[model samples]
Target: MKQIHHILILPDRVVVDDQPVTITTQGADIVTELYRRYMNDYPKFFKMDLLSRLGLVAADILLQTEGAERGAERDDRAVVIVNRHASLNNDRAYEATIQPDNYFPSPSLFVYTLPNVVAGEIAIRNHYLGETACYIAAQEDVEPLIASTFNEHTTSVIGGWLDVTDEKEFIAKLSIWTH
Candidate 1:
């Protein structure tokens, strides 16, 4: 069994240790709002998809609350997350770019169709430089993701659920755990 410290990132809020941190402001899009309000300093965040943004915000708060430094060089950590929609929102956006109206398929949008891109983003942001993955499952499950850590040289794991169906639909439950 894994002893874990967790955080929940909802559509319009960010919660750590069962306490909402008031991370978002009054806006139509919470992801954008949260990014602007809490993590606007990271320029790369503007280029990411909605799912990645949610994951980033959640991880940002979770790491901060857990006293983990993002810039610190650490390769012993791993990111293991599960999601439901799994980049479908970006897929739909990419699909629209190739339509008859404007037949220019955007490479930027095309690159984000992969669900693991969010994991990669999180890894890059935090400098984990270790095992990182995003599992596409029917529902949120920690077993497979957590189990992967056991096989790797991972000393700690950032594991959880990150699901984004569209702009307005998403949820992330993340945890920081040590083995």
Candidate 2:
């Protein structure tokens, strides 16, 4: 049987296993604060989109709290993420760059237009070589989407809802499931 461990990363607080790990009232600063407090060593974080930043931060918190291995390749661990917005935030930014007046599409922003990029970013950061999947679905379908991703080769999974809107509002509810 697989046991699921959960973490909720909100604009004001982060909770793991139903216990608040950190609290702050600042809205947008929570993401950067999480990066600074938990992952200051990864300079690449600054280059990622807001969606990826939220997912990465939530994954880091969930995996660290669960005592999952880090700095090591884990072929048996999979990363699966589902969201309703589907990278709309980055898409809007990229769309703005391609406008007639702006005509300067940013390659950096273009890279994150795909929703799966968030899952890819997390895999690269953690050295997880197992399956990485991202799906765009309704909130109620997220659990099924994540469950369907598991296979015989998968021993553990880091996955959940990672959604960000064009307005910069976001929510990440990640979990680590292990047998």
Candidate 3:
């Protein structure tokens, strides 16, 4: 049976190994606080969109320290993330960019309107050049993507429930499954 090696829950909290992280800080600085509390260095984190930011933070918490040293090969790990809003946060922002008043879509903001960008961001951060994909499911849908059951080629999978309704309303519950 596949086992869950680690897990992370966010924007307002961090839970690992089924226990609440007591060392965390809170409020509007949740991500920033968690980044400084758990990560040693990852300056590029600030550049990501809200969705990507949440995904990256969850991935880091799952792959930090001893978990990273496992040295999984480049193609051994796959990233499969699922979200409900499908970058609605970025979508709204992108729409604002192209409005009549603005008349010009911002490239950086336009680029992340796709939901898969969150998965891509995770793959880049963890150096996992394997199968990377994202699924758009309704809040009630349940499809399996976070396991070695993916296909014969993949040995492990990194993914889970990743959703962002907006900056203030979001949750990223991620985990790694090793088969």
**Overall lDDT per candidate, in order of appearance:** 0.78, 0.83, 0.74
Backbone clash tally (model 2): 0
Model 2: per-residue lDDT, tens digit, 140-162?
98777767767799877898888
> Which scores better on lDDT, 1 or 3?
1
Number of the candidate with higher lDDT, 2 or 3: 2
* lDDT of residue 157 for candidate 2: 83
Query: 81-170 in candidate 1: lDDT tens per residue?
Result: 788788999999999999998999999999899999888889988877888887887553576567667645778888688888776667
Ordered from best to worst lDDT, the candidate numbers read 2, 1, 3
Q: RMSD in Å for candidate 3, one decimal?
A: 2.5
lDDT assessment of candidate 3? 0.74
Using all chains and alpha carbons, the TM-scores for the candidates as numbered come to 0.88, 0.93, 0.86
Q: Write the per-residue lDDT of candidate 3 for residues 131-174, one digit (tens) a residue.
A: 98888875344235464346677887877788888767788777
Best by TM-score: 2
List the candidate numbers ranked by TM-score, top first: 2, 1, 3
Weakest lDDT window of 10 consecutive positions for candidate 3 = 139-148
